[model samples]
Target: MGSDFYQQSILPFAGIIIKICRAYTHSQEDFEDYYQEVCLQIWRSRDNFNAESKWSTWIYKVALNVCLTHLKQRKKGEQQFVSDALPDEVHDDAKAFGSDELNLLYNAIKHLSEIDRAVILLYLEEKSYAEIGEIIGANTNSIGVRITRIKERLNKFIQAQE
Candidate 1:
């Protein structure tokens, strides 16, 4: 991507992409791969974004979709090797959440079904149920219900860890 495009289009929303990528990836390497792929896809598909929604929303949708697609294409029944190092973009945000807590949360999130994972990630990012519903193709009511269930599941997972 050109410096101008990155500056004008991708730079402002890089955090959104990194956050979504972190949720969907297991290791720093995987996160980097997904992040690069998302950037490329965004540049390639910029024409499809018609300003119907916020740029952040479009980026979120694209990043989640790309990560989900990458996960599906990987071979099944294999372990995801995690590393301690966080990408620079994610490090500051992860610190805000507390690394251990964020690790536990993201690890729990990884177990959710793809769509449920997307919903919960958006919810964590403080997106409204209506906005998350629009991105994930669910209604607001369903987004709320799914988020409740996802939280219950996550609580159980965290408790089990403790």
Candidate 2:
């Protein structure tokens, strides 16, 4: 049952998990840990899904919540020491979405408040304001306003990098 549910449900939405984890983590090790936690969480919460929203929406919420919690825990000093050097193997996420501009954008995103990071990541994925609101627990109206502001802040950060 677990294998079947995983193949059918979790595997299909893995990209969403990957993207969210990438946005919330700085290093490859942290990304892998967050990805595993998110998958475990989605599996554990499978029975709790009431289907009020799409499965993808539920997955996003789980992934974001896990990452946010992980971030907070790290701030409290659960974080491990990592070197400043890049990993030998290019990150799969980086290879898949690699570009200087995207790197700059991601660096800018890291500066956002947690909620703003989630909002902009979903916006980049082209999720509708309604869907984003459903995932992030914001109203659709606020999602629109937040996205506008996030974009403005992102533009300034990116320009400053030039």
Candidate 3:
């Protein structure tokens, strides 16, 4: 909850939170909301962490769970809102990466099922199958199989965009 704790502990993993939030939200407002909620949850749940996993892995689990729950809540309400502008953070991310291909890949990723998006994002982050499995509560072998299928779907999606 303290700024020092955030600065030293949570801020280091902000990129992971940003990526998960972006995957779950379509607009900047929603993105900010999701991002804030994730951070808040991390702070609130800080004591719940038992150190059974690395801090980064615990962060991943928290971020993914927060986003997935937020997505489900939004779906239940089902209000449609469109925004013409991208989030500043997203634009900055694209610029930071220096590639439109990353944007294309993100667009394709948005089309995936929520769980698949998490899997691919973790895989893209170069997380080991065991780490991803530990985060998502799935078997490592299934994570591998799911990643293969998710990659195929993402490929189809990107190809269709061409």
Candidate 4:
């Protein structure tokens, strides 16, 4: 990766990448691996971006795809990484409630279907349905419906934990 490219392009969007990595990975090591891979992919695929959307949107689309691909490759029943750190992107109230609650939330999030996980993550980031649809290749209406279902499922999961 060119230094100028890293400085000018990737660095500005690293936080979004890191947050996505944290949401998808189980442990610190996995988070680091995903973060590195996403950054590398961004650099490697930089030329593929056609400037059809905001750079951040393209970065988010790439990051989510990478994480989803990595998750699918892991063997079922294999060990997953877990930690008490607050998930990287969430409301400040989540931070104030403490890491234990956040950990519980993360655990619940992990139980969701992969697409639902993506939907919820984007929702948490406050992306509009149209933006999410563009990133994930779903229609805006489907994204809305999925978000409703994901919220209901997450609520049930959290309540069951209590």
How high is each candidate's TM-score?
A: 0.86, 0.87, 0.87, 0.80
Q: Give the alpha carbon lDDT tens digit for every residue of 98-138 in model 4.
A: 47887888788888877777778788889999989998899
Q: Show pairs that collide, candidate 4.
A: 26-81
Cα lDDT tens digits, model 2, 52-150, are: 988888999999999999899899988543334322232444467578877788889999999999999999889999999989999898888899999
* Candidate 3 residue lDDT tens string, 28-129: 678777777787899999999999899999999999998898788788995344324443444565345347887788888999998889999999999999
Model 2: per-residue Cα lDDT at residue 140: 94
The alpha-carbon deviation from the true structure for residue 137 of candidate 3, after best TM-score superposition, in angstroms, is 0.9
Which window of 10 residues has the lowest lDDT sum in candidate 3? 79-88
Cα misplacement distance, residue 93 of candidate 2 (Å):
5.1
Q: Where in model 4 is the C-alpha error above 4 Å?
A: 76-98
lDDT of 2 at 9: 86
Evaluated at residue 156, the lDDT of candidate 3 is 92
- Which tens-of-lDDT digit does each residue in 1-162 have in candidate 1? 687887788877877888788888787678777877888889999899999999989998889888888888764654344333543654565455447877888899888888888988899889998899889988788877788999999999999997
Model 2 stretches astray by more than 4 angstroms: 79-94
Instruction: Single out the weakest 10-residue window by summed lDDT for candidate 1.
Output: 78-87
TM-score of model 1 relative to the true fold? Answer: 0.86
* Better-scoring candidate (TM-score), 1 or 4: 1
Candidate with the larger TM-score of 3 and 4: 3
